[model samples]
Target chain A: MARIVVEVMPKPEILDPQGKAVAGALPRLGFTEFAAVRQGKRFELEVEGEANEEVLDQARKAASEVLSNPVIEDVVSVHWARES
Target chain B: MARIVVEVMPKPEILDPQGKAVAGALPRLGFTEFAAVRQGKRFELEVEGEANEEVLDQARKAASEVLSNPVIEDVVSVHWARES
Candidate 1:
């Protein structure tokens, strides 16, 4: 099967409260030396087809239109690979 | 600086309601042919250190202990790279 992965991250200018919470807790959890922390979304699309160009384009369109809000989020990468 | 990315996904046995919702909407949004979809978390840790083995281990530990819940979530990949 082909696995398509899409990464959706908040815009650099946007305030991520959840990420902030995690960043605030890291030091307490004994993890430090972080310049910053940003929490985002990881989407795994298990496709029943091959990882062809057309399929990848369709996945990208889906990610842009449905998976993320362009105003607040940025689609970092779309990876298409055969996983088993 | 090194960018350490930790991908936290719901266990395979777990039901991902949010991913299901998105999958259900994709077809309506004119994107289809997806066999399955699982939504997860993408954590971007902007570290002030180099991408050495020790630092990578520390990042992995932080991801397992603080960033994700081991009972319901699994760390799919831990990526450490330098990005300009």
Candidate 2:
């Protein structure tokens, strides 16, 4: 078994109020010094069967199609991690 | 400048309908090899100044205090990657 990690993030042009909200609250919390922050989604898929190129290809499809909205979001990448 | 990544995941016992929703939709879309799926938050913090321990520590504090909900979510880890 292996794991596929799909990272879905909002397009750069899209306004991320959630990230901004957290960024705004950071300085107040005394963790100042950061210029910007972007919040996105991380998906962990536990593959029960084989974790091969076929699975990787499907994972990529799932990442772009099911995990993210191309109109508003950008899937940074989909990669395989060792099964833990 | 550097980047700080904060990964926040819901507790194991917590219900993750979003992840389940995605997982449910995947098979319909022809990606049906995963046993389970979990979705969480991935935060990217771009630091303007040096990416030192001080900055890393501050980033950790920001990650835990502002980026994650201690009650329902668990911050998996905080780490630094090369500035891109």
Candidate 3:
């Protein structure tokens, strides 16, 4: 089976409270090098066959239409897991 | 500034209800090519400087210790955003 990986991130203009919370907590935990944190979603879709162009196209459609909310999140990347 | 990307996924043996819900929804939405779906987290950590080896190392540490719960989640990947 092939796996397609999809990544979604909050839009730059959007305020991500969960990300903010993590950023705040990081310093307290002594990870002071990070200036900011943005948390988002990742998805792995397993298919019966290879992750060919057709499968990738379907994965992209699913990513934008079902996985991510276009109002606040952007579908950052979508590709075969092996490519990553 | 440079950004480090960290990915976390539920352990294989763990039950991922959220992922299961998404998988179930896909066929109903006509995206039936997928056999399974796994949901995970993507984190972008912004740093003041370039994402060099040291920064990536620190990001890896933070990913494991602070970003994910070792009991149920696994830090799947940690790398420079540019590389992705």
In candidate 2, how many Å is residue A1 off?
4.2
Order by DockQ, highest first = 3, 2, 1
- For A6-66, candidate 3 gives per-residue lDDT tens digits of 9999999999999999999999998888999999999999986666799899999999999
lDDT (Cα, tens digit) per residue for candidate 2, span B18-59: 989877887888778888899999998988888889888888
By descending TM-score, how would the candidates be arranged? 3, 1, 2
Measured with C-alpha atoms, the lDDT of residue A13 in candidate 3 is 96
Q: List TM-score per model, in order.
A: 0.94, 0.92, 0.95
lDDT of 2 by residue, A1-84 (tens): 588888888898999999998888888888778888999999998887987898888888888888899999998868886455
Question: Which candidate would rank higher by DockQ, 1 or 3?
Answer: 3
What is the Å distance of residue A27 in model 1 from its true position? 0.7
lDDT of 3 by residue, B1-84 (tens): 789899999999999999999999999999989999999999999996665788788999999999999999999999888844
Listed for each candidate, the true contacts retained, as a fraction, are: 0.91, 0.93, 0.90
The TM-score leader among the candidates is 3
Residue A3 alpha-carbon offset, candidate 3, angstroms: 0.2
lDDT of 2 at B60: 80
DockQ of each: 0.84, 0.86, 0.87
